[model samples]
Target: MKKFGIGQSAARFEDRRFLTGAGSYLDDENLPGQAVGVFLRSPYAHARLGGIDVSAALAGDGVFGVFTGPDLRAAGVGDLPCMADAPNADGSPCYKPPRPALAIGRVRHVGEPVALIVAETRARALDAAEAIFVEYDELPSVVETGAAMNGDAPRLWDEAPGNRCFDWYAGDAEAAAAALDGAAHRVELELVNNRLAPNSMEPRGAIASFEDGRLVLRVSCQGVHYIKRILLSGIFDCAEEDIRVICKDVGGGFGAKIFCYPEYVAALHAARTLGRPVKWVAERGESFLSDSHGRDHVTRLEAGFDNEFRFTGLRVSTIANLGSSLSPFSPFVATSAGVPMLSGCYRVPAAHVRVQGVFTNTAPVDAYRGAGRPEAIYAIERLMDFAGRRLGVSPGEFRRRNLIGAAEMPFRTVLGSTYDSGEFQQILDLALERSDRDGFESRRIAALQRGKLRGYGFASYIERCSGGAPEQARLIVGADGHIDLHIGTMSNGQGHETAFRQILCEYLEVDPERITVVQGDTDIIPRGGGTAGSRSVPVGGAAIAACARKLIRVAAGKAAELLEAAVEDIRFEAGRYHIAGTDRGLSFAEVAFRAAPQGGPAFDEIDEFAPGQATYPNGVHVVEVEIDRGTGVLDLVRYTVVDDFGQVINPDLLLGQVHGGIAQGLGQALLEDCHYDPQSGQLLTASFMDYAMPRADDCPDTDFSLRLAPCKTNPLGIKGAGEAGAIGAPPAIMNAVADALDADHIDMPATPRSIWKHLRKLAP
Candidate 1:
């Protein structure tokens, strides 16, 4: 409750270095006697590898070492890990295939690494890699999820026949069916959630070296601890205790960097075998080919309603494409995080959800920003609009009528995820008000006169972060007045240093400049759950707050002793501890100075852990658009969001998160799409030229308003803000697009050409 407390807008201190180009990132890391590495990748999406001829490459100029799958096999290195072996609804383990560091006999994806070429320079490595020849017999591939999940589809792996990774279901299937069967009215709609590349500003890469029997990697990743553990224990034959992962300044992750890619393994293996540092940096084109994609869902949503228009039942069936093989947490991302959110903000006695995680010939698919939650919201919200059209009701009015309102505290859905807290109606009302729902008709008429079509859309989404994992933190206070905090969560682009510093400083009653936040270094921090699922602030901040409270208690006792008073008589205010009735007091700095030089240290170092239940952050997003009838180009005019994130740590930081999420979400709805050739499985969108990214002109200024309904589980009463905008924005935009055209459906990236076709088809 101090000046720089939870609600203050503290400028991010890390930005100073980033803005000035002083930040140290992985690509900037250089070690002595280091060699560069380049990969030889498969040209065919599905093929049987006949043989690999790397001898000529090893003998090339400046070449240090050449490695293939056989080399890694000979070196006793293990295959890549799946991380989570999720069980299907029937309690059978998901079909998991071996993810080798290098493709041996078969390549299921076009960009699968087949050879690693190491040389004196990066260019030399690249040059030498071209000399290596690989023979392949092309095989059939099923690129689309709809086909991949078919019973007779071309199998990607023997274990997962028909390419179905898992058959999962949640909620009461029988009850939902019965309700739908007896309903007075029902609506069903199907759509595709187009795939998206994470495309972090800095591409994924790593520099690996072995020194004194320890392996160290300087990488751009979301989690260093997991990478170290995963590499040492699962991939390489090295002691887990002898590994170090240092993630200095990661530009962004958006869930792609969370995977332990094959390139990391190849670099580490090559470094250890050659007894030199080896570095591998992915080019943007390579990133487009290999980075984990998100939201490739072929889904059908069926909502049941009574004559009165009250909700009766809801059912969703989705095919989530895992892409070639399972990334670490792909199954979990498509199921637990994805399906439970299908209910959104509605109350239904019966609901059923089924997700068939299917594998295809493409880069692996996993968490991206809002992950499964966004895909779920997009389906339900779009269907809500479709149902509104069916019943001749306004989207806003229908949503308000059926929303699980404020009185429903801790509402447990049929999917079994307990909503911690939410005010869905309040959020929707505020969003509609801010977006001028009442004036939309007039605006539409005005736009019609100008040969433009105007429309309004709404999406209400719920996000569950803080995935029941305990976060760790260690606080160290030096006698010189330096307060350092080591947390387990990596920043990955979020303002962790500034936000955590503000939270700690508020408790210690210290200046913001007094604290230094260190993260993503396994050698420095004992344990952590690196940032994903928007868990950093909610779970990580709770850990820091818990430890801070304990530290304050210790500091108060020490202050009481120093002031010759009982602990109860000591009052700590404005960074100083004073005896109740007198002015005798000692500052925190003085206490640290006195206690450190003496027997007991003034600093309290405690490792704080879990406040486990997931926090639900739900929101309503309104998007207004202007469509050019002549050219078929759509212009986003206004976007307004009202969310319940429980509490705000830094309003500016939260707003930035919302803005970035909206931009990425809008990118998916209007610009970006990761495409693979349906027949050949060749990745068509493999570079910036083919893969469209949203620019400044593509996004409208976003207005964000927070409706506080503090979460009951976490210590800070704060839910996540990281993914709210992305989860809610896409459906709103697409719904508006559908509205303007008076169409039942329009898939994502509602590109100008697609719009032109839709408009043309409807023209009379």
Candidate 2:
């Protein structure tokens, strides 16, 4: 492989600047004559709004302004729109209540923004916000998913009876039921998927200003163009070109920062009204209370197997908590985004799923890391392990019997997903080999002698990725010899700079240093799809590759003219264009300079890649754990994974993505849980002190390897790798815990205390 080429493990060039504290983030931005703003949040989970007394806050020293929901409403500002909605079983649109930028009449959850306080400094804004007092009449609240779905639960919206957003179902329920009824063996399990906070390194923030009658927003977000469109079409009724969004380096998003938050809209309105820049950055505590969360679902899964242990049918019923209100795309996350992967890597002929989105008095739950894919995979894999144990069969053998063989390419699943390619069994076998599955018996015996229980678990998972909007790329061979590559997908610390530059290197045959990646600017790039659903590489990178190929074709034509050779005779190699049989040639840079001579035609190419179908990235994860019976402490002794992510752009960057995802999966499986007070509806785990994030010691040294099975859906033949680790880790680890305890079933976040209680209950 060529150094710094597609498959090479090039060192991340952006890391040096990041490590040296030279990265620009939302909080790092400071504009001239900029004023700081803070939100005054509600203290009650559910309450009726009475009267707001913001007179004192508005009169505070150095206070620029104070804005409320009514004020915004009076200005003709629109509500924050929910971009996605699922249809009810009756085909009616789901109950979607208006979500204003600020609290309109009643506050549904604690920390709902009531007013925006703008001052000269952050401290002054905060102090002014504290002085704004509002009268509240507390109402009964429901926090749990199941409780919210109950008829007796407090009605969040009068339009949505029983606090239900939508009653949605996929696949043929009759077919799944018949398959299950005729099966030789069956098993069922019910569990909670647990809510979680995103907790990115930098909290969500934005800086907004008005320039030349246009609103300019600099925010920590996943996509700039997406934000601009949402602001114009959803919040502010302005022309598309009236707003420009620019995002620089974002610490992390994990799907939480993809939407148009009220702060962004309020800041823009404030800036336009005041004729000065307005900035708002969430504090750590504020982020916990307000940032979009993930994965709060109560699901009951039932599966049936034939006499030969082949998967006959799968049925799932889930109540997904949408939290206080619906965030953009939240409705689809638990429905279409995940329902398609209900069977995972198995070849189930019949499957059905019923998902009812419910509203609860808590932070809105949206996509995080693997989003709905993780929740779906966790259900199937855990059920597979449980069904195997019930049928007196090994987990590996059971999975092997039902795995979708490579020969079954382009298999149409019962849940509506058509998998293009995968080697599920081969990946599983590799993971088992790497984990020393055959030797597990001996290890278990040795551990038994030491008063420990050793168990091994397996999880085979797949997800539909690279299925979203098209991505655009524009390449400009600058007059200064630097190749500028522009794409719409913004990087939230996913190493896009390195991975994208590598793609350019393979086509341009130029040094990685000569390419500059420009993204997250709507003004610079006309359009983009932004980075979500792990589509950056498969979708955006493909666009870059296409653009580079176009550039090379154009350059070859220009090189032939400069070399005085026929275009057909021009051979491009190692960044040099030469005649077939002569030494007469020009370096790529030299040709670029000459092609775009001071007064000559400029060299640039624009391209877009819209994948015809989504790629299904599949993987298998095997975990071995030792549980100390005395204290119910579990140690993940070994963890192995083999994934088929199609074509990898940068091996080193791929590993980093996998490692980070595993750490998050580990946190969700063993430590992290976003809890709300059952009676008070208050967030219990609001800070790091209450919530347990996985430390380095918590994540095992993962034994990871790629089992290449190139996807056929995209031009580059690359599947998404961003969410794979998180999707597979949860079920593998949970199955291991179940094996150690010899329990029929258990929910996620198997903390030490919960395990100890389970053991004590089983003790003689």
Candidate 3:
């Protein structure tokens, strides 16, 4: 690979500024005469609001205003919108309750914002917020996903019977039932995908100002346009042009910051009323309570196998927790986002999945890193291990027997997902080889000598990249031999600056230094489908490639005129244009300068690209673990992965994404769990002292490689790699742990205590 071009490990352009403390994050941005705002949150999990007295807070020193839910409603502020649409299995509309900017008649969860206090400083805002008194009649709360549907469970919404939001059905349910009934063997397991807080390095925050009857919001979000649309249409009921959203640099947003929060709405309302910029940033504790969480599902998985041990059918029924209310993409994540992937990398002749979205007294749950794909893969992979154990077959061999083959080029699963291109068996074989599968016995014996139990596990997963949205890219070729590229997708530490420039270098044949990447501003970029679903490189880069083609075509016409040759006779190569069979030519800079005497861009073009279908990124993960029998301490000994990501942009950044994802996945498998007190609904893991993030030592050195199988559906022949590592790591680690313990099954966040308890049951 050439340096500073596609496939090369080029250094990130934005890191220099970030490392030098010059990155302007949301908290770092401030306007003149800005006031600070703090939300007064509800202390009870579920309560009826009788009255709110904000008179004392408004009279306090430096307190500009204190607003409640009634004030917002009186000002014509609309309810927060839920953007998901999934009808119930019986074809009825999904039950959707109104969610206001602040608590109105009732508070369903602890930390629900009840009032906003704006003052001269953060300290003053906090002090004023403390003075507000609220009367509440507490009600019983349901905290667990499985228990939300109990007959005696407390009801969060009167309209939703049994606290069920939507009971969705996907795939061929009748066929799946028939296949399972006819199968010779069957295995079942009940699984729990633990809830997790996003924990982005920079907590969620927003700065909003109202000037001249217009709203300006500076938020740390994935996309400015998304925020603008939600606030204008969903919350404020203002015209599109009435709001301007700006996001320069974000510390991190793994899907948590993608939605419009009530804090943003309150700040905008306060700024308009006080005639000053109002800013609100969550404390670490506030983030634990307020930020949307991920992956709380209680699933019952049943797999049917034939006499020959081939998978015949799969049935999955899950209770997906939607927290106290619906977030933007909560229903979609629980249903369509994950249901199609239940078939995994195998050829299941029949499959059916029913996900019931349930409400509970906790924070709203929505998209995380892998979103629904990780939860789906974890369930199927764990079921694979369980089925293999019951049939007395090695997990690896059983997976091989059912694995989809390379010959099936456009294989469509029974669940309706079509794999564009993959070599599942080959990837699995490569993972096994790289992990030294044959030598595992020796390693197991060595561990046993030290009073440890060693085991090996495998997880083969296929993910449907949510790149269906169109992305826009605008390119400006300057007269000074430089290019400015503005794109729609924003980077939350995924290195869009380096990777997109590499795409430009490949097409324009220009030096990387000559190109500048611009993103995250709605005013500048016009329209974009902000970064999520691993679509930045696959969909956004493809748009850049299309825009580059248009720029080249238009530039060629100008080059033909400059060369005094017929348009068909002109040939362009390496940033130069020449007449066919002649050496006479003009450089790109010369042509650009000639076209624009005022020294501006010679060519400006914008292109929008949407792939014909979503790309499928498939891979195999193999993990080896050693456990201390006496203490139930597990150590990840070796981790190996073989992925087919279609095309490579920057190998270094790709590795970084995989490494970070694995760290988070490892945390979910062994350490991280968002716990709430069942009786009180108080968040137990409200700080780092209680929440266990995976340390550096928790993740082992990974043996990673890629099997290049360019996607057929995407124009750039690339697939999404953003969420692949997180989708594969958890189940592989859990399977290895189960093998070491000689157990049939276990749930997630297999902490030391849980592992010890399981081991003690086996010792007797």
RMSD values for the candidates in order, in angstroms, are 1.5, 1.3, 1.1
Q: Tell me the tens digit of each residue's lDDT in model 1 across 131-183.
A: 88889999988888888867767788888767888898888899999999999
Task: Evaluate model 2: give its lDDT.
Answer: 0.90
lDDT of 3 at 274: 85
Model 1: ten consecutive residues of lowest lDDT: 595-604
Q: TM-score, each model? A: 0.98, 0.98, 0.99
Ranking by lDDT: 3, 2, 1
User: Which digits, one per residue and each the tens of the lDDT, describe model 2 over residues 1-764?
Assistant: 54667888888888988999999999989999999999999888999999999999998999999999999999888888888989988999988888887898899998899999999998888889888989999999999998997778999999998999999999889999999999999999888898999999999999999999999999999999888878877588778888899999999999999988988888898999999999899988899999999999999998888999998888899999999999988999989999899888888998889999999999888989888999999988888888888899988888889988899988998888899898988888888888898899999999999999887887999999888899999988876568888999999989999999988888888888888899988889989999899999999999999998888898899888988888999988888999998888889889888878685435878999988899999898888888889898889999998989999999989998988988898889999999989888899888999999999888898888998988989888899999888898889999999998898787879988899899999999
TM-score ranking from best to worst?
A: 3, 2, 1
Residue 423 of model 3: what lDDT?
A: 93
Q: Which residue pairs does candidate 2 place in steric collision?
A: none
Number of backbone-clashing residue pairs for each candidate, in the order shown = 0, 0, 0
